[model samples]
Target: MMEGTILTGARIFDGERFFDGHALIAENGRVKAIVPEAEVFGASDVTKLDGGILAPGFIDVQVNGGGGRLLNHDPSPETFFVIARAHRKYGTTALLPTLITDTSEVTRLAVEAAIEAAKADEGVLGIHLEGPHLAPARRGAHLAELMRPMDEEDLDLLCRAAGEMPVLHVTVAAEQVTPMQVERLTKAGVIVSLGHTDCTSDEATRLFNAGARGITHLYNAMSALSHRAPGLVGAALDAGDVWGGIIADGHHADPTALRVALRAKRGPGRLFHVTDAMSLVGSEDDSFELNGRVVHREPGEVCSKLVLENGTLAGSDLDMASGVRFGVQKLELSVEESLRMASAYPAAYLGGEKERGFLKLGCLADCVHLSDDLRALRVWMAGRVR
Candidate 1:
């Protein structure tokens, strides 16, 4: 097989900036270089792209399912293929298959599944355990009955999983999990994220300092900011070293509020986009079960927009491509910034392989080709077109 190809003639976002007329050269599933179009004489094919934007393929750190397959409904290693293929069509070349609050046994199965998928060199970048360790007061769509504080067995399972998975992320509540536990998880190389909390800023900052590197779906299912008590939202915006993920699907957060959060994010770490996507993404079906409860995509809602009967947002019907579009068209984020949130920032947070996120020389050639309106047209992952 010819292992090299040069893709040309699109506006390329190199993570930091955009350049037109750049040729991205890939060989053997890795980037050779991005050179001037004229300089890209190659041993294989040279493909000319239609006018649009070309950016690094999105890396979603919090995806529940894709392609009409819900991970929680089918928590087996083999199911990752269906989910990965589903989300790939929407430009998420890499993702963490998120398992929401479930039993201990199910959690173990999900972790094993992720490890197996990773071993098979599938599109899974990691595993996100969104929790059985969440605060009941804030457990949005999570099964409150299954929720509880983290115990020793839970901690041990997580530690073992971290050792096996390329990346292991767990979402917990600040009040539910002690700072020492958070420290231990971080020490074990797990990306411990605080979520589903009603913690005060003082408690939130303390937890962040103790090793909670991130906050999940910021401003949702967590305490909102108030003058009397700057809550998790305030802490997430102010914590310079902590990353925050936002749904930004109009329902989860308002565009003006999203703009404010983005502006206020003082960072060595900043806010990034996550779909917190459900099974309906990249699929025609809009109804799925979450923990034995039916969650349906609202009528006529193209983004999926899954919600429970009581109108509780279960998970996003959103995909990475559409999330980027929301940022650009709805929130008015610069296309560069939107793309960064969907791709570079999540890769930076995972901190697994440096070659995974950006489209730099020596990096893996995971890329997305988008239409002018910001819809994903084609995706290239692991140097193969998908």
Candidate 2:
């Protein structure tokens, strides 16, 4: 049997803070300790890294596809594995395979696939269903015909799925879902997030009070924050108990806007980074099908973005590591803060912080080794290298 493993030679960031001249020890797929290098004396499998940062592995909650696989295209356990493996290369140790606005049959298939995949892969956290319950006006890439109000049947499926999976996140618009529905969904352990809506600030807050705790891809598909009208964007920033997810790709929201959000956001509920990644990530393809429509990757001078032929923004080509770099280099956030936005904050949003987001004792040994430039060099999930 294996005793333990020691990873040294890099600065360790334990989700909340940084430790220098320390070595991390892992055993039985959990963090054993983080001690000074001199104290790591026992015989163990040691992997020494060069000068860099060893931080908690990233947890992405809004990944639509990766490795050329789209959940909407193929809702199966194998597809989830493909997506997990693809994002794992970019330092994501755990992620929710997202499906954007699909039919009921496809949604049911995805729920089953996620339940099975969670049993096989620790990296497959759960599933994020980004709506058939959405506002048609704000449907960026989602087909308008598929958008509809949340009925009892829909709620029943989601509530049951939540009971069967580790996490079942659903995105809905306040206009499409009643507050009562939101309350029941939350009571059933569903992580309800508001998105793809044109609801007013008051309408959004009503849902927030009703049990919606998160805002998806903030400032993108929802209403904007204007002086006269604080839309969903304003409601999200102002709500202390609500968490917000931002794409952080330079193409989605301006760096200045993101910086402003970081400062203006309320406490206990801060803004975290999410890839909102699509099939373009970890793939060579420049385009993919979204709801039978072709979405092309348009190359920009600084970064590329996926858009439909009509020029509507699709998902994104961003990866978790690149999103972290953007938070630091573009948003002017400190390294520790940026890392937290990627790992700790999202994990907190999904209520997985106790195990997966931190490198403290008893936490899962999911760690990422990054270069000085913040690129992922090596990734380990549950103390085993991926």
Candidate 3:
């Protein structure tokens, strides 16, 4: 019989709201209960935390790399492990190892790596392919030469891969991927998101209707929102069934713009935080190569940015915790909402809400204990402290 371990002393955020004076009980790699702290007469262990917030571990859907490992550099299970382990330190218990625009051979290897990684580690949720099918004009840091329209072979490969993995999120431009392709991918259980496009609002909405449920890194690498045009940005904000991921590091988007998006966004779909993190995170290295270009991290007192040689903003040097902090401190969002954006919103977006993104009874005991300042103090994956 597995004995329950009671985690007490900190306020618990059970995905939706806070529970004061409650204790989280874990047993057999799942949440057993959320009982009152005074009633925590556990059969086995009791770990008392100091002060802070205890919330569900963050689930990042778009992680390019971490811990000096880029998925594109080495699309293997070992690289997945390294990246997962690196972000785990920052309260991310689960994430999709994202691959930037790469060759078809590399993409196949990454899919295989992700499948293998998920079998061994519950933290590896699946894979996100952020395109070889993007528009050149909005191809922020992705290689332009490699970008192309999706072919029949590409569609077949993606549909097959989606069947084998837990999640297969692909970012494609409306200009490159047809609505029929998007519908086919969505039917195959692939989460199709729009990005790196210069599509109009009507074009974006047509794809959204066809089954693209997400907008990648809203307002960046996509068409801008104009009063007359109302581009992809406007389409994302107006659509009630679409979720958008934003890099809240204050570099990819302005604080005011983020704040306005938060309020302007419709329901059934919400904006969530995605680090879009790179290999620089959890590593001492200041620079790394992306598609043969040297990307450097511009360090700052509050935040840092990774940029290419020509100064195009590349992936971010952010972690889940720091993003949550930025939401509360900069965006004026409540701590509960900020934490939900990191944990619940993304999990819901990934369609894994029931098993993840909550501290409810019977949910996976993947959790993070954050200090008052929102730094991760301790983490637990599957009821085991890591």
Which candidate has the top score in lDDT?
Answer: 3
Candidate 3 off by > 4 Å? none
lDDT of 1 by residue, 177-226 (tens): 99899888999999999899888899999999899989999889888999
lDDT of 2 by residue, 233-327 (tens): 99899999999899888888998999999999998998998998898888999889887789998886335888999998898888899899998
Candidate 2 worst ten-residue window by lDDT: 297-306
Please give the lDDT score at residue 284 for candidate 2: 92
TM-score on alpha carbons, each prediction: 0.96, 0.98, 0.98
Tell me the deviation in Å of residue 302 in model 3. 3.4
Residue 306's lDDT within candidate 1 is 79
Root-mean-square deviation (CA) per prediction: 1.8, 1.3, 1.2
Total backbone clashes of candidate 3, pairs 3 or more residues apart or in separate chains: 0
Error of 2 at 371 (Å): 0.3
Predicted candidate 3 versus true structure: per-residue lDDT over 215-330, tens digit per residue: 99989999999999999999999999999999999889899999999999999899998999999899999999998899998975346989998899999999999999999999
In terms of lDDT, the poorest run of 10 residues in model 3 is: 35-44
The models' CA-based lDDT, in order, is 0.85, 0.92, 0.92
